[model samples]
Target: MDLPHFSILISDKQYRKLNRNIWSEKPVEAELQIEDKTFDVDLLYRGNHVREFSKKSYHCIFPEITAGIKEIHYNAEFMDKSLMRNKLSLDFFSSIGVLSPTAKHVLLSINEENQGVYLQLESVDRNFLKRRKLPSGPIYYAENDDANFSLHSPIDEDIKDSFDSGYSRKEGSSRDDKTLQELIYKINTLKKTEFERAILDYINIDKYLRWLAGVVCTQNFDGFIHNYALYRNSFTGLFEMIPWDYDATWGQDINGEEMEFDYIPIEGYNTLTARLLDVPTFRKQYAKIFEEILTYHFNKQNLYEKINVMHNTLRPHVLRDPYVAKFIDDFDREPGIILKFIDDRHHYLRNHLQDLR
Candidate 1:
């Protein structure tokens, strides 16, 4: 009736049901179902494979090709180039120990008016979770699901324990001081492991947390821990930190009243695993990365410059283009509506490290 909006058509790829890894299934390519037409599409994996191509329960019917898309390279009217630049700029800067990712070159397939930019990549190897294991006993406690702190209305600790512990026949150790100590040990062990040694790309996750501090106090950004985490390679169990989703990042007027704020940390230099950093190790390693950033694409000055450039670049054109005008109008009018969270998101990134100097 209403043009059917956007949808997705999956290629016959035999991917693992649990995780979205490239498995041996003699897979075909994916197609995009926009309205009634289907267009050929390529797969772009970001952060972890968990959400890659995973059908969202709500939007599973009329699937949008852009749904759950983290990073991609394309020549779409105004997409890829802009979005990719934002992502990769942060990413590249991140690799250099900046609180972002480094920019990988864009591979373009251009002709006249349509130049397709595909293949956005960098040398930062992916990593997976560490120290994950089968539950030994009851895991959650009655208090773990505090109403004041719960975000997703996590099932009560008893129910969670029951399901996790095969109907609560046994129990997992409590997160006592000893348990916390064990977690600390396990985290440290992984940090110095041969697996981690290989990824000595100088990941200062602490820096990102530090950046979040500004987001909290100044930007009032409601950044959360669960929103960001460390990634790891499945085979090797190495940890690579990433700050993926930021839809609910920018906060509005609040007296810092959210209990979740208390439960989940939004500041302080730390690890993706919520580990407090070794002060000396953290500073030395981070400084090395910062210097490396200076030696390369890590440009703090360039970040602010880029933001100012975008405001100017998009302003004149958006004035003439109805689509762009609407995009901005909707963002301002509803304030964090339409594209949902991108406006507040851009605000945070655009103004994140401005006070660094």
Candidate 2:
């Protein structure tokens, strides 16, 4: 099936301004045409280091266009040869009942020039919470730089202060550092036994375990440290982990290197995971969750079928994508790599989880 089409119309002057300093957060006026409808939007170049690349990502705000749906993201997926990595990973998370931003493949054009096929992702903002029926709570994007869940700053530091520590609050009225600072304090100061109890008290353990399983199965090393969101559910009074920026997953590292199946540990990385594994109960639970994922969702056959469908859908557009076609030698071979990674990763995890148990 052909993917949906989205066209952004901007003046030559505005387009030049946007490309002049790609790192700028300056919003340029544009008209977004989706299907048969047109809406006015403010388009801005997004991404930390990706700004330096030719294939640029964008953040669009439909101020006078729509309600509830205020913003959307267009990810370039420049490093990925297959170009289906992010969409597939997010679909996998959703299939396993994880709350993640919705994504779809789209044939994108800027002004009248064909930009290429881009993954259009739903913004993980208040609209996300409303659509998912999740409780309204503070949402913080774990910034790409310092997303490590560690207590590196003083508790007294104003929550409003921008620290290179990499935490950016997206929602919530009171922007004081108290809520997050308290959580960090608890994570750092609490004893092992106390931490086990406190972590369970503050975060949803089952959801976290499932998220950890997804991260391990996908081999998303970057996700462990960054490119995720931690939201405190008002009703449950516990934080839930949300997946983000999965374009580099499925046997590839951040630098586009081919990753080995045995790279990531079954216990996972980060202090929170380390502390959780320290507890006997949490370890057993993790082992069980890992096994369940392999048996039910993370198997080679299920993944291969999904990959085949996406490959078939995207083959035409990928071949025509100017940016991707220039860099990738053989787009046909990309699906095989993902299939092999699934086979190898599943086999490795089966044995690894057994050893852990």
**lDDT for model 2:** 0.82
- Number of the top lDDT candidate: 2
Best by TM-score: 2
TM-score of 1: 0.36
What TM-score does candidate 2 get on C-alpha atoms? 0.93
What CA root-mean-square deviation does each model show from the true structure? 13.4, 3.1
Q: Model 2: per-residue lDDT, tens digit, 1-357?
A: 888989999999998988887878889889899888888999998888777788888999998438579898999988788888898899998877678888998989987689888999998888889987888998888875456666442244334333325677898755534677677667767898788777877878988988988998899988887879988898988888899999888898877779999999788887678778788898899888877789989988888878988888888887788888765555688899988999998998888887566
lDDT of 1 at 303: 45
Record all residue pairs in model 2 with backbone atoms less than 3 Å apart, i.e. clashing.
none
TM-score of each: 0.36, 0.93
